[model samples]
Target chain A: MPRPQPEPVQVVKQRRDAALKAMVEGVPYVQWLGISFDRRGDELTAILSYDEKLIGNPLLPAIHGGVTAAFLEVTAIVELGWSMIWDEVEAKKLEPEDLTAGALRLPKTIDFTVDYLRSGLPRDAYARARVNRLGRRYASVHVEAWQDNRSRLFAQATGHFLMPQRDG
Target chain B: MEDRKATLARQFIEAIPHARALGMDLTELGEGLAEIVMPYADHLVGDPSTGVIHGGAVSTLMDTCCGAAVMSHPSIPAATATIDLRIDYMRAATPGQSLRARAECYHRTRSVAFVRAVAHDDDAERPVATATGAFTIETNGGAT
Candidate 1:
């Protein structure tokens, strides 16, 4: 009749660390986008370096709107994939190599919404995603992207992703 | 003049940095409609097990197609920018098949254009994803 206790901090940290490692090393598309994670603090930040190939407008020299959207989406996916903890049995059995080689499935997106607040300049950008809700089969994340000044945001996105089955 | 419009559309699409990166090709252009294609590449795969294309790639395709539609509108603007966009993924796109996006700018005001688009692989009825977006219409030396 009592609620189950939450996972211990150490165990949770270990799983989270493993997930992040897999996200960076295992995913080739993430590498193509030049996305990296900054996990020095409590929050994980997605970083997009300025690339000439990401420009959408030659006139304004602006980053492509779609590229910005893609960057935000990838950020949300990374946030969700890196924080998900597997079941106890699977967690115990997972090795670093297993985690790297598709031990867990990537979350599939159901819907994605992006708002362009300002034109993205041709510069490095940073984004962060926070999970609003995490159900057993679904998760919703809100993400924001900024360049130079955080207050002067470039774009924001909200996404719903279908989570992988935990026990299967 | 029609040929000029087609040339302009192609130039505009090719000028986009992300479109070039994704190897997007402007396949068709009309008064308010545009179609673009993105070939499948291993680097674009999201689910390695299934070899399915990433959702972001689909989003990029739709977004680029939508912008192209806006640019090809009869009352073309000097410049346009995306205001907002929403995409719903219906299903995963079949791997190794190029994705095609068809977009239409259904309505336009003095400063805004509304567009809707769908991305599909082989089956036209079964779309991989769909999108709706608003774009800003900016004129040179004119009101926004």
Candidate 2:
């Protein structure tokens, strides 16, 4: 048997970028929130751009608690879905264009728990999700969001999702 | 005390920029209880194909309701901020329908308040989602 050839660096980067873009575009809420992703290989950092409409407490001028939760939830869902589709995209079994709006089914949230550590200031917030457990039918993801320093998290969440069934 | 809390609840929602953007209205408020409604909007849709509102939007509604509940609680009449919130999405909210969240502060200590809330559209029998949360009760001064 011949050894399998490794994909070129440029090819790998293009595929990853395409996959991430398609997945993000599929969610309308992500667009409404003006959320963007900074991808470095399989790692993803979700960014929520600062907006006046995101403020919950005018006195403190703090970001809404719900907005923070939404950011963490979106991060977890996207990161989880990307992990599942990475191999298919890399193997050329799935096309990036095919993952466009509603083409790829993202997991449904069963439950989510969020903890607020500090008040979210009026600024851009960043988050990253770690897949704690991924199974065929269920997945658990933990996400942490920070505004200024990554070590100091403003909010964090753990979400359990019901994975979409794969087409036979 | 009851009247004061109700006034506080209304002011609390008014001060929130996102709540105003979502068109959330406070329908009811009492001691340790609050009810808020958010009208359906295209911008809040999670799946364009289904037109279903995003779970994140529902979570926002519930979180705000819980905060209001905490603020109205007799034990913690001062301001409050969310410490932790757990939400269970029972089903997708019906498209083209507004969502209402009712929350109650079931328990409270000197510095913390516990809240439980449910969100629904036209069908209040089956909630679209439910939430339980803990909030910090500010003792020094209200968040005003």
Candidate 3:
């Protein structure tokens, strides 16, 4: 049998975009929080747009800590899910079109620890997650959230997730 | 004094936009302890397949409860912000069931307060999640 041809760069790009979209759309809380993701290849940056409903302290005019935690958790889970999907697609084990809302299973959170560096200002916030470890049964992700400057993070978190079982 | 703290805690939750949006109700409050309830809503669902509430929603509940606990503490009846929080998910919250988070500010220093909390649904015996947190203590009415 002839060897399979490598996918073109453009084809790879489209597939990546589809995968990221499906994964993000799978959760309703993301929509509830009005969170969006900007994708560049395998990298994702989660954005929590500013809204009056997001304010936790009206006096300080600060974003809610719970909202910050939700944003960071969504970033980590989506980033981890995207990495898994990308790997699966490359290995020809999955297809992007097959992914849909609630179709792809995301890893479950075992524990999450968040450190608040500063009070989040009343504005848009951005977050990105780095996968520290990925195993067959578990994964660890660290996420950082910033408002204006990338270096000046207002919050950061580390989370451990239980991976979903794959069918043979 | 207890009545004052309770009133402050209720006012605290009311001033929060997100907490109000989520329909959090201050059920019980005392010195260093707070209990808040969040009604189940369609938008809070995380898994559409199972209709389970999102873990992030639970996290928010716990965080807010912990903050209230810190603020109501006798040693620190001023505004506070979460410094750090760690949460563990014990199980998924049942859909259509309201969740309640109870928090206690078990310890405090000049500048820091320690809190622990648990979230539960209708089945109070089994907690849906538990959290431990630290908060910045502003004893002089800094940010209230």
- Interface RMSD for each of the candidates: 1.1, 0.9, 0.7
| Rank order (by lDDT, best first) | 3, 2, 1
Give the DockQ of candidate 1: 0.70
**For candidate 2, what is the DockQ?**
0.80
The residue-by-residue lDDT of candidate 3 on A139-167, one tens digit each, is 99999999999999999999999999978
Q: TM-score of model 1 relative to the true fold? A: 0.90
**Clash count list over all predictions:** 2, 0, 0
DockQ, all candidates in order: 0.70, 0.80, 0.85
Question: Which predicted model would earn the best DockQ?
Answer: 3
TM-score of chain A of 2: 0.94
The collision pairs in model 2 are none
Taking all chains together, each candidate's TM-score versus the true structure is 0.90, 0.93, 0.93
lDDT of 3 by residue, B1-144 (tens): 768766766787789999999999988876899999999999998887789988888989999999888877876556789999999999999899999999999998888899999999999899999999999888674544
Of all true interface contacts, what fraction is found in model 1? 0.75
- Give the per-residue lDDT of model 2 (tens digit) for B1-144: 868756766777788999988899988886889999999998898877788988889989999999888876766465789999999999999999999999999998878888999998999799899999999988766442
**Candidate 1 lDDT score at position A60:** 86
Candidate 2 chain B weakest lDDT stretch, 10 residues? B71-80
Q: How do the residues A57-122 of candidate 2 rate in per-residue lDDT, one tens digit apiece?
A: 988989999999999999999999998898888788886557778777888899999999999999
